[model samples]
Target: MSININSKLDSQNSFWDINLEGELDVSTADKLKEYLHGLVEQEVVDMKINLSSLEYIDSTGLGVMIGVLKKLRTNDKEIYIINPKSNVKKIFTITGLDKIFKVEG
Candidate 1:
């Protein structure tokens, strides 16, 4: 399955909420990287990625997220990941990424 990213700015909270669906694998990792990098470049302070609808993810996808978090940290920004499915959550936990990034319910 292909990955799809839908995003919108929350004016009231001044944060960008990104909803990701479908699969996040090697092929789509670059797309995610570019999109997230653009947001960081634009000086977005807070980012919330909703992964509840995401059906699958690979190491590349996780790397893309980590790269984004690193970029944000450089700019003193923060990234929050929300509602990851159990399988996906396991990957984060195994990789110790759960401690590196904020995961919300």
Candidate 2:
């Protein structure tokens, strides 16, 4: 299934809370990237990506996340992923992204 990404901004913390669902393949990665780009343009300070509903993610999705992390770091912002699925967590673990990005419970 195609991926669905929805985002909400937290006024108190200046954080973007994103909810991602469905499959994050090559076709859907661009939407995720664009959402993050918009957040960057606003100079957001923190991000909390909720991945509990996400079903699947491939390398393209991983690349998009890595790119976002790099951009956020350049701006001195922090990004955290919440409740990643086991399969997706495995991918992050294999890529060593679990070390780079903050994975929250």
Candidate 3:
């Protein structure tokens, strides 16, 4: 129902380390989008998102990530998805988004 996002920018501002903890659905998708967009606006070079604590993700959540990826790509930046739970990882695989985003176990 609610998602908690914790993020830290590296010393050089080269990348952001973000952790997601909760369901990522329509109700919570906008929060993520806004947060990431704000970082992009600040010209973040890259992002590393840790999803080990994330419980769920729906289409809207995926869309938000895609949108952010697109925006980051414009500046040649990228997002690295880390430690996604099995179910969440499956969503990316089944949707063929695995190839689009850099997913790590």
- In order, the Cα lDDT scores of the candidates are 0.88, 0.87, 0.94
The list of candidate 3 runs beyond 4 A from truth reads: none
Report how far residue 100 has shifted in candidate 1, in Å.
Answer: 0.6
Q: For each predicted model, how many residue pairs clash, with residues at least 3 apart or on different chains?
A: 0, 0, 0
Query: How would you encode candidate 2's per-residue C-alpha lDDT over 42-64 as one tens digit per residue?
Result: 76577899999999989999899
* Model 1 per-residue lDDT tens digits across residues 1-105: 588899888879888899999989999999999988887777567899999999888999999998888878886878898999999888888989899889887
lDDT of 3 at 101: 96
Query: Ten consecutive residues with minimal summed lDDT in candidate 3?
Result: 38-47
Candidate 3 structure, TM-score to reference:
0.96
The number of residue pairs in model 1 that clash at the backbone is 0
Per-candidate TM-scores read: 0.93, 0.93, 0.96
lDDT of 2: 0.87
Error of 1 at 33 (Å): 0.8
Largest TM-score belongs to which candidate? Answer: 3
Candidate 2 vs 3: which has more lDDT = 3
Q: Candidate 1: where are CA atoms >4 Å away? A: none
Which stretches of candidate 2 lie above 4 Å from their native place?
A: none
Clashes of 2: 0
TM-score of 1: 0.93
